[model samples]
Target: MIDVRDLTKVFATPHGDWLKAVDRVSFTVAPGEVFGLLGPNGAGKTTTLRMLLGLIRPTSGSATVAGFAAERDPAEVKRRVGLVSANTGVYPWLTARETLAYFADLYAVPPALARQRIAEFADAFGLGDFLDRRCGVLSTGQKQRLNLARALIHAPTALLLDEPTLGLDILGRRIVEEFLELVQARQLAVVLCTHHLEEAERLCHRFGLLNRGRIVRQGALEQLRAETGLHSLHAMFLDLVGARRQLPVTSLKSAAPPAPLT
Candidate 1:
């Protein structure tokens, strides 16, 4: 349901040279599958997502969400995708129920069905007790859960989650995991951008390891292990960085990104 090919984004640096935020990145997420876009800070994962969502235009290449080209059919693509980021938030003064309702309306969902989805999400996210409470009064976890529900208020075919489980307690993380499972059960494609490698291993069916704006390695976890002889995503991730970390600064800056997995 989500496809990106040669998706590149370049920005002008302060010194007037170009910086490639994302470089020829490519991936696909099928229905009922989660594809982890794993990387560290400044790795361009979020830039890739922003390009996919058409929030920012890419320098080149294509992104198609639910078969609609993001550059050409942005509105349709947006309608078919749900986005949840750590920064996603609800209106402080709006009641929890009101916030969901507002989002549903923005998607043009019918009133009756919107009410049904609101109820289902409230139950799924454990918002039952505070469904009528003002969002500003809700706890951190509560707000995060509400943000998750709000992203899916229209029941999009794909979900793009960037750091959805960041800064939360164990319970909050568990709830987010359960919610991802629930969405997968409904056959939604998911693109998860996160630094939480252990969580990614547990939740993602496949992963693309991005570094310095390029895909350094990508495949199913087992495939990655077979190629690298690394037992865990965390280990493989460290291996990739370790391989480059020892290089002198000049070589590191001039070095090309690792080749894609065959």
Candidate 2:
């Protein structure tokens, strides 16, 4: 389980300005449930996840992951969490098998067990064809699969995914969805951060809609539909953020002119 309470992050700019990237966000994620942090770009979703993972210290409030305080016991939190991102951070020079082996070693898995786990995941994710191929040689879809495999090498209790399908085609997207289904079947807690409303609706049990550094609304899909009177998540998002205006840019010219020419 994960518990976040009034979490906040403030950045100090070079010009003596403070920017509030995350503003008093709070939410709880139970074991074995898929919870989504849905928002557009710059909506504080990444900041909130970073805080929960202890990548950056929060300016205020607290987060606990698997009953360990995120700030004080970041190592313990990391031990229980698996992270996957559009940028999987695998070394391009390393082969897929080597990459997985490297992370398994970092997690201190015994060499024998690591080898067994790598083989299991490679077969499950269909990486046998390219397990020995350098990461740089793999296609985008193949790389995404490798990324998911790497995250699962440790059999973590919680999974944190950030735009996992950012640069994939339809087939690749389906591959990711299928992998997610498998993860859910294992009853792993998942925190998914994605801009795709349909994907979230399909995978998440509940969702929190964030905007302008705050959680504007949150609930199950059915509850959101009932509360907003909207049938689709896309429509709910548009209504929450206000529909995009189609006004022309040239209409904003000012009438005032310079009084004197130097």
Candidate 3:
């Protein structure tokens, strides 16, 4: 359902420097499969996703989603894909039902079908009781549920999720996981970008470890585990990219103390 080949994106910095956020990355996500883009911050996952969604242009390479070229036929690509993110762009003033209806209109879903889908998703995601409540009044978990509902209102063929469970509690995360399982059961193609290895292991059939603007490893979960001789996804991730840690850089001036005390 999705094919990407040597995709790269470079941003020109104000300092006359070029920052390559994504470099020579390539992978394919088949129908009925959940593909995970696993990486740490600044690892190029978001840049690659934006390129695939046609939200940003790539410096080089190409990608196709649902048979439409991502760069050249973005409209066609958008029509076939649904997207949900941690910072889902939802209007705080709109009620949950209104939110779904609004997206339905954007997708040009038929009235009757839209109503039916709204009802189904609201109930499935436990948004029925709060359907009339304004989104701003909802909790973090409720808002996340509403985000997923909005994304599915049109029943797009593919899904792109960026940190869908990023700020949620345990219960909220489970709800997202369950919804994703349903998507998989329906043979929908899904590309998930996340830092949560456990979530990826639970939902994804295949995995790609992206590091330093490139895909360092790609394979099925079992294959990656076997090839890397790792017992768990976390172990495999650390083995492939090592652990991510912050380094504090202290200035020499700061280190030189009490110079005037004499």
Candidate 4:
């Protein structure tokens, strides 16, 4: 499970001004559920994920994965979660089978168990044909399949995906779409950060729509549609962000950050 409460990040500009990258963000993802964090560029999606990984300090608020506070226990939170991004690159010299084994080793998975998982993901992700081939020789779809499998070799409880389908052809995107179902079947809590609203609507169980450092609105696809009187996330998003004109962005100084889930 993943829990975030009142997460915020502020950066100091060269001119001695503070820029708020994320503002009082809070949400949760139950095991086996997928939550889409949809936003335009600079909506604080990456900032939020970085804080959850404890790569940077949050100006305020907290994030926890599997009961480990990300700020206080970075290593433990990392162990329970895996990250896959569009920029994920496989080692060109490593064979597909070797790639999976290498990551399993990094996580200290038993050699015997690592082999078992390699074989299982090979079958599940249809990597059996190219399992022995070097990553450099693999097609984009095949390489991505291996990348997805590699991230899960240690059996993480939660996964963070950033534009997993970006720069992919139709076939490569299809491969990722199929892989998402398998991820869900394993009961991993998933946070999908993407600009692909259509894809999110099809894959995510719920969503947190963010704009200009704030979560302008959040809920399931149907709920968001009903709330905005729009059919598509693309449409709903535009409608909500436009509403921001009247909403007025303000400092959260007096606002209490969301409480961690009990």
Q: How much lDDT does each candidate structure score?
A: 0.91, 0.88, 0.89, 0.89
- Angstrom error of the Cα, residue 175, model 3: value is 0.7
Off by over 4 Å in 2: 244-262
By lDDT, rank the candidates, best first.
1, 4, 3, 2
Cα displacement (angstroms), candidate 2, residue 54, comes to 0.7
lDDT of 2: 0.88
Question: Residue by residue across 113-172, what tens digits does model 4's lDDT show?
Answer: 999999898888899999999999988778878888887998999999999888778877
Candidate 3 RMSD to the real structure: 4.7
Which digits, one per residue and each the tens of the lDDT, describe model 2 over residues 142-182? Answer: 99999999888888888899999999999889888988888
lDDT of 1 by residue, 40-89 (tens): 78889999998898888989999998889998988999999999898887
Each prediction's total of clashing residue pairs, residues at least 3 apart in sequence or on different chains, is 0, 0, 0, 0
Cα deviation at 233, candidate 3, in Å, is 1.9
Q: After superposition, how far is residue 260 of candidate 1 from its true place, in Å?
A: 58
- For lDDT, the strongest prediction is 1
Count clashing pairs, candidate 1: 0
Scored by lDDT, model 4 comes in at 0.89
TM-scores for all candidates: the values are 0.91, 0.91, 0.91, 0.89
Clashing pairs in 2: none
Candidate 2 residue 77 C-alpha distance from true site, Å: 0.9
Candidate 3: C-alpha lDDT:
0.89
Report the C-alpha lDDT of model 3 over 66-121, residue by residue, as the tens digit. Answer: 88998999998888899999988678899999989999999999989999999899
